[model samples]
Target: MKGKNIRLLRYAVQYWFLLFCIYIGYRFYLFVRHFETGGVSPFVSRPPSVEGFLPIAGFMSFKYFVLTGIIEPIHPAALFLFMAAVAVSLFFKKGFCGWICPVGTVSQSLWMAGERITGRNFRLPRWVDIPLRAVKYLAMGFFLVMIGLIIRTSMMVLFFITDYYKIVDVRTMKFFTEMSTATAVFLVVVGLMSIFYKNVWCRYLCPYGALLELVSKLSPARIRRNKKACINCGSCSKHCPALIDVQHSESVSSAECFGCLTCVSYCKGEGALQMTVKIPKKGIRSVRPVFYVVALLIVFYSFVFVAKVTNHWASGVSYQEYMKLLSKQGPTQREHPRLP
Candidate 1:
């Protein structure tokens, strides 16, 4: 019953975030349509939060900031959103991925749906899984290395100021709304895979997840088991979405541990498993789920609040400016305005 309540609380939070993403998508669609229809459609203000989709842009923005000490003005929100996600992972173990990411929510829902429809979701064999799991990390590394090379070439500044960079968000929208045959097939394959295998994209292809997992490796927080309190029921291991062997493991500090607290919530013994953070001189103290949730929310929003106060939350390019850049864009626009 307690575990069910815990799962329910997580579901409420997940769906709330998913709904918010849907709302953002709708508003952004209207915002794009206002430009696409040449002032015929009702205008809507672009939501800065939509920039959350632009993590690569955020990555470039971070690199630009580190190199030139200036935030990329065109997608200022991208930098802040990326920072918030990294902060969440640093302190709360990929809470952004496990709790706030729309993609993650969809992945979870797809697997849940599969379980409901097919009676179970399947895990890959360990021999096949380990190498596949490294794919995300390899992808992340490749991106970072490419970015580092770009920075060395000093083309980063030129890339950022390009008209192409300014309107990439619109291109992103079109990628979904106007998928090519290849793109459609690719998505369908991925969707089907997600139904059969839990977190197919998340576990194998998400460079962002790999990045978060890397940062979370430094987090002092982990799932800890108390031998005395444990009933040796193996329920925690069975319930762990990440497939961590929480039943026998004294510490679950793996990169796979995204701190979802499933093991703790599903533990049959009352005090067997806990989410704990090691403190300076205070030892490891158990953290309540409510407290963890509160801290995660506060940490994430605090970054946004800072960005807001500093006038870094919104793009410097106004709606009218966007109108000008997107003036020639039509329903099936293919060419993005190149470096200008």
Candidate 2:
């Protein structure tokens, strides 16, 4: 397939996933509204996909599951979704961010628009860029250490049952809907920076992206350059959203290579740059852009499929529990819980 077609398909996929996420979010809002409105509004099903936003909860559940061989029932989907993301990075080189993450899609759209409006996105100098990139890693390390030390293995399942943890998703939802002035300002600044620089939040601030990027470094599939077929037009490097120098590099070893294949799509020669997997005996088998995207979908959904079949996808939060918890968080209740 032509690179142009691949890129076009990529846009379609990105927008479609973004829309789906919006749908999930809207449904979740309605679900919460039923409790808030004292059943005056119609009830909507609480979407399990909303658990995707609860990554901190997901990370904790995942650690608990790994150590105890028991899945916390409160937010089982969080662990599964988190596992799926890590699994995607493990096999497909952070394609989750490139293909599925709504944040990445929004970031890409902002930067692309900025490029068209400003004639080009500005690249930070090496010294500045390198240190900024380290910010995400440092943040990731800090959380990993803190969460590790604070939540011991013995306290894992117990922590999940706490009222604070049970209501965390609600807390997260309120965090966005009821953002403080500082958070609002910070987001605005990040959005403007994303306009001027490529993926400013993902590149410099998102610890989740940092974790995925680190895991993607181990992916067997990678974009390799065939220098002999290169025309040296530097199109690959110029178009790279991650700012990777694809023209000079033999293989994309950078953690920033997120399997977008923007480099491959822009390359002049068919074989000049390719995302390929090294075979056991056979030579490295090149992956088509179409196949790469399809494989990503398959890998992701396969995890979802297994989770569903094994009853790991839904939250164990019963309707009564949600009503009890969310009502206390609703308009009627104050900070203190009312006695029945």
Candidate 3:
């Protein structure tokens, strides 16, 4: 029974991880299709009145949405994804990290490649690893200060409602359509970095992942390690994609733990680790030194962000004038202005 349970859990993780890659890959393919063909991507359908792809609608993922265009408020799909992430974490204890994150998938792919090329494995020293982990927190804080407060109130409003909409004019489209050499080089650099480091970007950078980790810590679903059940074999930690020391902690550290089922799958004994929901003691919640700093930074920078946005100094340009400008230049009425 235990063996069957473990197998089932592993399969579930594999399926979700696969699905995540397919979804993101599909999105990328769509972008490339449009970029190459000068026609709408297959993934995006346009109504008769709409000459090209339909206006980007749905989802309030600031990370992707903002990068693509001015962020619309949280869409149902983005909210659904968020809720789904929470639900999965609650029930499966970070299965999302194990199964859903494309970045994690990429990291694992690189690790496999490294193993194939070099007979040795990669491992960072504790001294370098500990401080490097702080990078994500700092990046998250920067976003919170820049977007959540400052831009949302001041600059973001103008962009989302106006200026940003215009910035993606025909000229801008042409520029991106002919992606600059610099942008191409940047992408190559990112790809190379992934091959060399275990999750170079995701580990020390991704603000979105940092935010999710913060919420996951509050999630009832957590990995519970039963120290009494087993030998001190370090298989669990060895397999951990996020490099968490699951063998030592009763409750896996939320900040570092991706809720990947690697530790659970690798554990030799049955019931050594299980996902469960339970509240921590009041003081236990703030026990980690990093937690306090994260909390303080979020609070402090949120105000700064708000002040900057209200000051009307944000970078996004307006939508209507952008359209007029494009219309004046040519008959490219089909092009829609995108947000920065």
Candidate 4:
């Protein structure tokens, strides 16, 4: 008999989280509106969850924290959120991508809609697919070089202290509210492409996902196959959103595995596929989907709760600072004093 499938439960969790994210976005909009209107509107305090959208800023905060042993005051919530993501990857192997990320949820929804309409999603030939998948890694490499290498230590400190960094959240808010023609077109194209291909942006262009994949290589929890009980069936591979060939491998160690457990859910053969940990000489240990889900939530929210208790969840910038910065009309007017 097949094990109890958790795919529906996973969907429930994804949609629940997505709804919470949408609420955060709306709350943030009101907060920014209060500033943009010069306090004419009723004030809504900014939600710390808005920092989740600032991944690039979070990356900087993470590096600065590592080097200086301080979480920078500008976007401290970003650092906490970033650390939570890394922790999830360390223990659960990109479970954040599968369970929590709004972008991933959107991508999954688009592809599922496509499958419903067209009967199935399509895969590229290996020659084309292999190169396309490298695009995310290449993008990750570019950021690593730009932030990790080229930007010197003193410059990073100065950059964080600048007025521009102080109001980056406002700038980000404007970017989405005032989307340009080019950005609109790019999103449209990506959306349409996702109809035919599974997770087009995630599979080929998400630098964040790429970084998680690298970190998750060290994760102990993995999908293991029982060859002794195996009937050669390709169900696992067929259901895999990441296109991993789970049937052929003794252990699913691929960086592409997002820990969705679609493979484990689909396998009907007894003891054929399971999410488990295998230590040398210690033997294999099975892990349930619910356990992974609970673990991920605990790690992520625990960090957030600690940050709140420590008063690091909110930005240090004051309301007066936000008014002075956002009063400027456009990007050109809001340029940092230090920028050329």
Best by lDDT: 2
RMSD of each: 4.2, 3.8, 10.6, 4.9
Q: Is candidate 1 or candidate 3 better by TM-score?
A: 1
Better of 1 and 3 by lDDT: 1
Better of 1 and 2 by TM-score: 2
Model 3, runs deviating above 4 Å: 1-94, 152-155, 163-193, 279-340
Candidate 1 vs. true structure, TM-score: 0.93
Which residue pairs clash within candidate 4? Answer: none
Candidate 2, run of 10 with poorest lDDT: 331-340
Q: List runs of model 2 lying over 4 Å from the truth.
A: 328-340
TM-score to native of every candidate shown: 0.93, 0.94, 0.61, 0.93
Query: What's the candidate order when arranged by decreasing lDDT?
Result: 2, 4, 1, 3
lDDT of model 2 at position 217? 88
The lDDT per prediction is 0.84, 0.86, 0.51, 0.85
